[model samples]
Target: MMTIKNSPASQPMLSMTGFAATESRFTGGLLLIELRAVNHRYLELNVKIDDNLRQFEAQVRELLQSRLGRGKVECRINLKSDAAVANLTLNPEMVGQIAQTLAALQQHFPQAQPVNLVEVLKLPGVCQTESIDTEAMAQSLLNGLSQAIDELIAARQREGEKLKQVLLDRLQGVREQISIVKPLLPALISQYQDKLTTKLREAMQAEDDRVRQEIVLYAQRIDVDEELARLNAHIVEMDRILTAGGTMGKKLDFLMQEMNREANTLGSKSVAIETTQVSMQLKVLIEQMREQIQNIE
Candidate 1:
C-alpha cells in the first residue's frame, strides 16, 4: 500500500529495484500479483503463472509490458481455487461406442478378461463437459494485477524523483564549489605573477619589462576561468532537464561526463590550491551522480 520511494536513510536506498505485492480474492478464488523490478538496459518482463491460468498469459504480459518502459520486471500471477465452479458432462455417444467395443472384446475372451469400471470410465468419453466462469476469473485476476501494476509504476516514479533530487543537490554542490573558486582566480593570477616575476628577476637576471609581461600572460592562460564557465553552463543545462522531469537518463549521464571533463580540465589548469580542491570535489560529485544515473530509467 505504501508506494513511496524506498529511501531508508539507514540503508543504501531501495535501488532502482523494488517489489509490490497485492492480493485480491476475487470471483470464486484468489488473485495475487507480485511485481518485481530491477535496473535493466531495456524494458523486459517475465511472467509466471500456474497451468490453470496459462491461457491468460498474453493478457498479463501485455498489461505489464505496456505500463512499464524500462527495467527487467518479473510478474507472478496466481489464480487459486477452493471449490469447483461447474459440473463435467460425459459424451454419451462416444461412451456407448466404447462400451460396445468392450462388450465385443469380452465375447472373444470370456474367461480371460474383465473390464474395471474405473478403466471403462477412463476411456476418455465418460467425462465430458467442464463448466466454470472463466471470464469472471480472468477479469478478477486482471483487475488485481492492474492495481498492483499501478502501485509498481508509482513506486518507480517516486524513486526516480528522489534520484533527480539527489542529482540536483550534487549539481548545486558543484556550483557552490565553482562559486568558491571563482573569486580566487584574479588573486591566484596575481600571486603567480608576483612569484614568477621575482623568480625570473633573480634566477635569470631578466629585468626586461617585455619578459615579465610574457611570464604574466603565460600564467594567466593557465587559469581555469574558462573551464569553470563551461562547467557552470553544463550544470545549468542539467538542472533544466531535472526540472523538466522525463526520461532524461542518458542526457543527464552525458552531462555528467561533460561536467567531469570540465572539472578535470579545471583541475589540470588550476593554479590555486582552493581551485584544485573545488575541482576535485566537483569530480567526486559528478562521479556520484553518474553512478546513480545508471539506475534511472
Candidate 2:
C-alpha cells in the first residue's frame, strides 16, 4: 500500500531529469537499485539486472511508468551474494570425470604434478552455486525502489522551482518590452504619414488624393497592435500554467512557440529603431524561456 506523498497547496513544478538510488541487504545477498531520468518526448524505460533478478522486469517497469509521465528513465540493479551463499558445491559426476582424466594424464607423464583440489574446482562445470530466491529478491528490490522514487521526485521539484522563477522573470521582461513598444506605435504611424506626404508632394509637385490612400495602406501594414495583444495574452497564460504546476513541459513549450511567432511578426513590422530593439529583446527573453522549458515536466 505504498503511496506518493501529496503535493503541497503551493504546488512546485517538476523537472524531467533526476537521479536516485536505494539498497537493501537480505540473508543471502545485497540488492542495489539506481534510477536516472532525462527529458524525452514520451515515457521511455530501460532496465538492467542480473539474470537472477530478470523475472522482476515487468513489475519494475510497471512501477516506474505509473510514477513518471515523461522521460527516458534508466533502472539498474546490482546484486552481490554473501560468501556463504556463493560457496561452491562439487558437481559429483563432473568431478568424477575430471578425476579420471587427471589420473590418465599422470600415468602418461609420471613427472607431472598431481592435480590438487583447487585445480579440479577451477575446471568448468566441476563446481556450482545454488540459485537465489527470485520472489523474495523482487519484493526487496521493489521496496527499495519506492523510497528511491520519492527522493527522485523531490530532486526534480527542487530544480523545477528554480526553472519556474527564471521563466517568470523572462515573462516579466516580455511584458516590459510590450509596454515600451505600445507607446511607440502611435508616434511611428504619425511619422510615416508625415514622411509619405512630403515625399509624394515633392515627387508629383502637387497634392493628390491617391497619395493619401497609399499612406493609409502603408500604415496599416506596419500596425502591430494585434501582435502585441496576442503576446500579452500568451504571457498571462504562461504565468497561469507555471502557478498551476505538474507535467507542464509540453504546454510551456507550445506557449513559447506562440510567443516567438508574435515576436517575429513584431520585428518584421518594425518602423523605428526603438521598436526593432524592443522586438529583439522580446525574442531573446522568449528564447531563454524556451530553452529552460525543454527540461521541465
RMSD, each candidate, Å? 7.6, 4.9
- Writing each residue's lDDT as its tens digit, candidate 2 over 230-286 gives 988988888888888888899999999999999999999987899889989998999
Off by over 4 Å in 1: 1-16, 84-130
| Top TM-score model | 2
Candidate 2 worst ten-residue window by lDDT: 205-214
Q: What is the TM-score of candidate 1?
A: 0.77
Give Cα distance to truth, residue 51, candidate 2, Å.
2.3
lDDT of 1 by residue, 1-297 (tens): 877796433212223566889987755678778999999778888888877889999998888877676788889988656466435567888888988997888888889657787777777558764555789888888888899988887787778778877887888898789889878877776777777778887888787795668766866777676787798789889877776666677787788888888888888887668877887898899999999998887
